[model samples]
Target: MTQNIIRWAQMDDIHDLAYVYSESYRKAYVGIIPDEFLDQVSLNERDQYFRKSLSEDKQKIAIMSLDEKAIGLLIFDFQGEADLPENSAEILAIYLMKDYWGSGFGKLFLNWGMDRINELGYANVFLGF
Candidate 1:
């Protein structure tokens, strides 16, 4: 089995991260979200968003790679809802390339994110999707 690495995302990973996000969104949300909206998605826009995310101190955005190719993206933040516990963490999003789906990478990524959140002193962690 190929090894997978989960690491913090960098500026250079913006394009690959965008591609993974766009393709995964298109595949996963086909019937749920409007096709027109998905069609209008742009890699450049996603790249910009990720660029900003990388600079945010509160947000934790990470990339998962298998054999040196980026296959997924994960975003989490300590910003919690009012009703939630203090110092709570929320998993804003997690997306993987369709080809990697059901290959246990998702579980691996979730565990990795949870570990990081715990290390950051969060009292609770919730997954948004």
Candidate 2:
């Protein structure tokens, strides 16, 4: 119903990212990941991890927003020293709120991420499931 855009994650986005993480995980991973695991993924834990990740300065996070509300999150490992497969960075995770599914946001987000990598001058990029 509204326009959405994807952008890099910031400290200000931690809260909304947590919300999207819960919503998306419950819906998308229901049959793939253990229900208990999903249920146990506490916001506090995720917050701690996100905070720690922010501190790391190597892992990167991106969020998709609709009307300024965070709806999806993407994380990638920035490898400046050719740390990943064939010197290509590997995406760690990409999660989106179920409400955005079938609206073609996923591919947009993915392609946008790749473009970001390109912007960073990364000639090769890959994602791991």
Off by over 4 Å in 2: 80-83
Query: Which candidate has the highest TM-score of all?
Result: 1
* Model 2 root-mean-square deviation: 2.1
Evaluated at residue 7, the lDDT of candidate 1 is 95
Candidate 2 global TM-score: 0.88
lDDT of 1 by residue, 1-129 (tens): 877789988888889888998889899999999999999778888887888877665677899999989999998887777877888999989999999899889999999998998888898888776
Whole-structure CA lDDT of model 1: 0.88
Candidates' TM-scores? 0.91, 0.88
- RMSDs, each prediction? 1.6, 2.1
Q: lDDT of each model, Cα atoms only?
A: 0.88, 0.82
Q: What is the lDDT of candidate 2?
A: 0.82
